[model samples]
Target: MTQPIFKDMLVLELASVLAGPSVGQFFAELGARVLKVENAATHGDVTRSWKLKAEPADTDTSAYFCAANWGKASLALNLTEPEQLQQLYTLVAQADVVIASYKPGDAERLQVNYEVLQCINPRLIYGHITGYGPDDARAGYDAVVQAESGFMYLNGDPGGEPLKMPVALMDILTAHQLKEGLLVALLQRERTGQGQLVQVSLLQAAVSALANQATNYLVAGQEPQRMGSEHPNIVPYGSVYTCRCGGKLVLAIGDDRQFRKLCAILGAESIAIDPKYKTNYERVQHRQELNQMLHQLIAQQDRGPLLQQLHAQHVPVGAVYTIPEVFAQPQARQLLLQHPGSKPGLRQVAFRLQGQQELDLSPPPTYDNYLS
Candidate 1:
C-alpha cells in the first residue's frame, strides 16, 4: 500500500501539556517528521508526571505522556543560549510547520514568534495554541478557558453552578482547531507564497465547539441549562428503560416514530398515542413521569438482550460504557485502537499502525536522547 499523506512535511512541535502536542501527534500519524522541542533543564512536558509521581527519567512510563508524545522525535534545547537559538532558527528554515503552546508573552520574549520564523522560512505554517486570546494576560488553563468562554455554564446538573467538562476538552478542541488552522495556512501559503500566524485559543475553541447551543442562546435568550444526559427541548429523546431477563436496559428514543416503535416493542402502545405524550414538546415536559413509568417497567430487563433488540429496531439506543469497556469492545477492536508494545525500560503504549506498513511506537525519550 502507498504511504499516508504528509510523508515529507517537517513539523516542529514546541507545545506542552495537551493543546499543541495533541495536534502534532495527529500530524505525526500521517507520516510527518515531527520533532517535539522542549527546554533541556525543565521537564520536557508537564504531562510527563501529570498522573502519579515518578522519578524525573521515568516519565516515559506515564500514560499521560504517552498519549501526546507518541510517534514523534524529542529534541531539547535551551533557547537562552545564542547557539541553541540559532540551531532552532536553522530548524525553522527547514520546517514546513511550526506549532507552539506557550504562555501569551513567551513567544515574543523568546524572539521565536511567527514573524521571526517567517524570516527564516516564508512558507512555514506557524500555529500557536494559547489558553486565552492573544492579548489576554490571564493564566489560561482548560477550566479557566471553559468558564470564560461561556461553555462551563452549559454543563453539569440542572440548577447547579456552572461546571467545566471532565476532560481537557478546551485544550483538545483547540488542538483540532490548530490542525485546521494549519491546513488553512498551508492552502494560503500555496496561493500567496507567504507564511502566516495561525493562532487558536482554548477559550475561542470552547465557544466554537458549542455550535448550535451558542446560537440558540443568542437568538432565543434561553440560557442553556444542564440537562444531565437529557436533551433540552426533545422529549422521549433521552434515556428510557426496557425490561428483559432480570435487569433494566436504558433506551434512548430520539423521535416520535422511534418512541412509537419502542412502545410497540414494549407492548405499551397506549403511552405512545396518549394526548399528554402525543407531541415531542409534551413528552419533554413530562420527562420525569415518563422516566418513572419506563423505569418501573424496565426493571426486569437484561441489558444484553435489550441492546440486541434495540439494534434490531434501528433505534439509536446504547448503554453507558466505561473507559475500559470501550477499549475491549468489538468495534474498538475493528478500529485497531489498542497499541501493544514495551518501552525500553518500562512499558508504554505502542502506536497502532492503521493499515500502514511502518509503526513508530518508541517510548518517550530519555534526557540524553531528548537533547539530540
Candidate 2:
C-alpha cells in the first residue's frame, strides 16, 4: 500500500477548541503525527467541559471535544511551570508545524509566539488563528465573529431576527483558510528551506467566504438582506417546498433548461414556456409568483416520487434532512471513522487521492494520555 502524503510530518497542536484543532486533525487524517498540548492547570481544553445535557458529567471527554480531536496524542502541561514549558520547547525543536489559536498577545505571554519558536526550529511552520487579527485584543468566538463579519446580518428569514448558523461556521471557515495557508507555507519551505508564520482570523475568513453576496453589495450597490434559503441572483434556486408527504425538499435550478425540466416534472409544462419565467433573470423578477406556483404544485406530490423523478431527469433537487437523516445515507456513512471505544466521528479530510486506503486512526485522546 502507498504511504500517506504527510507520513513523516509532525504537528504540535497548542490550540484548543475548533479551528486550530481541526487544522491539526486535517494533518492527522493525512497521516501526520499530531501531538495536542493542553493546559494542565485548566484540566485541558475548555471543550472537554462543553457537554450536552444528556452527557455524563463525570467523563473528561465530551462529544463537542471529540469533533476535531481525532488521531492525536494528548499532553497536558502548565506553561507557567518552567519544567513543563521546557518539555514543550523540546517538542517544538523537532515539530514540523505548530498550530495555535492564542488570542492577540497570549502566545507572546506564554513565550510560544512564532518569533520564539522560529529561533528553536527555522523550518517549523507556525499556523495561528485569532478571533479578529493580530491588532485586535478581544477573544475570538465563532458566533461573535459571524455577527461582526456580516454573516448573521444576511442569514435567516426576511424581516425576522438574525440567526447564527447551527454550526461554528466562522471557526470552520478559519480552519480551512489556515489549512490552505499552512499547506502553501510548507510548499514554500520546500523551495527556500525556511518556514514562516501563516495567520488567519475568524472574522477575515468569514468575510472572505461571503463570495457572491459581498459582490452583490460591492458591485451592484445592493445590500443583501435575509431571504431564508433563497439566492439573491437565482430564481427557483434555494427555495424549499413541502410535499404532500410532509417532507421538505429544496430546488437549485441553475439554468432555464433545468427550470423547464423542473416545471415539466411538476406537471406545469405551460409555465416552463411562459415568458415571465422563461429565463432565470425574468424568473428572478417574478420570484414570488413563480415560487407560489411551484409551491402549490409541489405540495400535491409525494416527496419520494418527486425526488426520484427530479434525480432521473437531472434536475437539482434534494430532501432537507435532519442530522440523523443525513447520516442515514450510504454516502455519508462512508465518511465516518469509528474508534474502538469512542463514538463515530466524521473524517476531516474529505478529498480522495489515487490509491488511498482507509486510515486506521486512534480515538481522540483522554487528558494527558501520552503521559500515561
Candidate 3:
C-alpha cells in the first residue's frame, strides 16, 4: 500500500453526523492523523445507532456511522469538563485543521469557534458546516434544505407532490464542498503561513449542485417541475422498457441520429423515416406516443439481449440496478469497489487518493469499551 498523503498533518474533528465527519474521513484516508472528538455522555454521534430494523443488531453496528467514520481515531471527551477542554485546546494548538458542525451560536457557547481557536494557533484551518448557514437563523435538515434549495421541486412526478431524495444529499454535497475548502486553505497556508475560517452550508451546496436546473430558471425564466424520469428536451431519455426478467432499461438519445439508430435496432425503421419524428424537437413533442410504441415491443423481451443490441447500435442505455445488484455487478466489482477485510467482513467504497488503491485498515474501534 502507498504511504498516506497527510501522514504528518494533524486534523482535529469535532463534527458529528455526516457533513463534518465526511470531510475528516477524506483527510484520514489520505493519511492525515484525524482525531475525532466526541462527548461520551451524549452517546457521541447519534448515527452510531441509526441502523435499519432489519439489520442484525441496532446497538453500535451502524452502517451510517461506519461509512463516514472509517480511517480515523476516536477520542471521547466532554467539552463541559475543564480537563477535557484543556486537552482539546492543546490538540487545537497543534492541529493543522479543525472541522466543526455546531449550529450558529453553539460553537461560540462551546468556545470552539474559529476566533477562539485561531488565537490559540494562528495557523489553524477552521471549517464550519451548517444547515441553512450561520447567517440566516433558519433551521437546517436534509428535507428542509432540499425544499429550500429547490431540489425537492425537480424530483418525482410532474403533477405529484414534490419530494426530497431518499438520502441526505445536502449533507453529502456540503461535505464535498468542505473538502475543497480545506484543500484550498491548506494551499493558501503554504503561501501565506496563515490559516482562515472556511464555511459550507447545506443550502448553498444543494443550490450549487442544481446545475442546469438553476441556470434554466435564471436564464429562461422557467419553473422546472418533476418530470417523472423523463427529460425535458429529449425524447426516449428515460425508462425504455420493463424486461421479462424483472429488470428495466433507461435509454438516452443525445441526437436524432441515435434516435434513428434506436428505432432501427427495434426493427421499427419506419418510425424514424416518418416526417413527424424526423427531428429531435418533433420526437420530444411526440415522446409519449414514441414511448408507448417502444414499450409495447420491448415489454416481454429480456434485458441482456436488448442491452447487447443497444450497445452494438451505440445507443446510450443502461439497466436499472438495485443497490445489491450494483455491488455484485461486473463493472463495480472490477473497479475494486469491494475491499476484503476481516472482523465485520467486506467493505465497499472508493478511495480518496488519485492513484492509491484501497487498503483495509483495522476493524472499527470499540470506543465504548477499550480497544483490546
How high is each candidate's TM-score? 0.89, 0.98, 0.91
Candidate 2, residues 1-372, lDDT tens digits: the string is 689889989999999999999999999999999999999999999999999999999977799998999999999999999999999999999999999999999999999999999999999999999988999999999989889999998889999999999999999999999999999999999999998999999999999999999999999999999999999999988999999999999999999999888888888899989999999999999999989999999999999999999999999999999999999999899889898877898888888999877678888988858653
lDDT (Cα atoms) of all candidates against the true structure? 0.75, 0.93, 0.80
Any runs in candidate 2 off by more than 4 Å, and if so which? none
- Candidate order (lDDT): 2, 3, 1
Best by TM-score: 2
Better of 1 and 2 by TM-score: 2
Please give the lDDT score for candidate 2: 0.93
Model 2 is weakest, by summed lDDT over 10 consecutive residues, at 363-372
Error of 1 at 361 (Å): 4.0
The sequence of per-residue lDDT tens digits that candidate 3 reaches over residues 1-372 is: 566667789998898888888788777666687888877778778788788777667357476777677666788888878887888998898999999998899889888899999999999999998887898755568888888888888889868998889888999899889988989999999999999999989999998998877777888797778898887777878754787777888998888899888888788899998887878889878878888888877776788998999899899999987877887886666543233452332232354457665554544444674211
- lDDT-better candidate, 1 vs 2: 2
Cα lDDT of model 1 overall? 0.75
Over the stretch 1-372, how does candidate 1's per-residue lDDT look in tens digits? 568667888999988887788787778767788899987668567676676544454444466666576667888888888899998998999999999977788888888988888888888889998777789866569888888787787776778878878778888888878888998888888899988899988888888888767776888778777776567777655564545654434556677888887777667899989987877878877889987877765665677876787789896777766667766786565433234564322112234556665445455544456644
Candidate 3 yields a Cα-based lDDT of 0.80
Query: All candidates: CA RMSD in angstroms?
Result: 3.7, 0.9, 2.7
Ranking by TM-score: 2, 3, 1
Q: Which residue pairs come into collision in candidate 2?
A: none
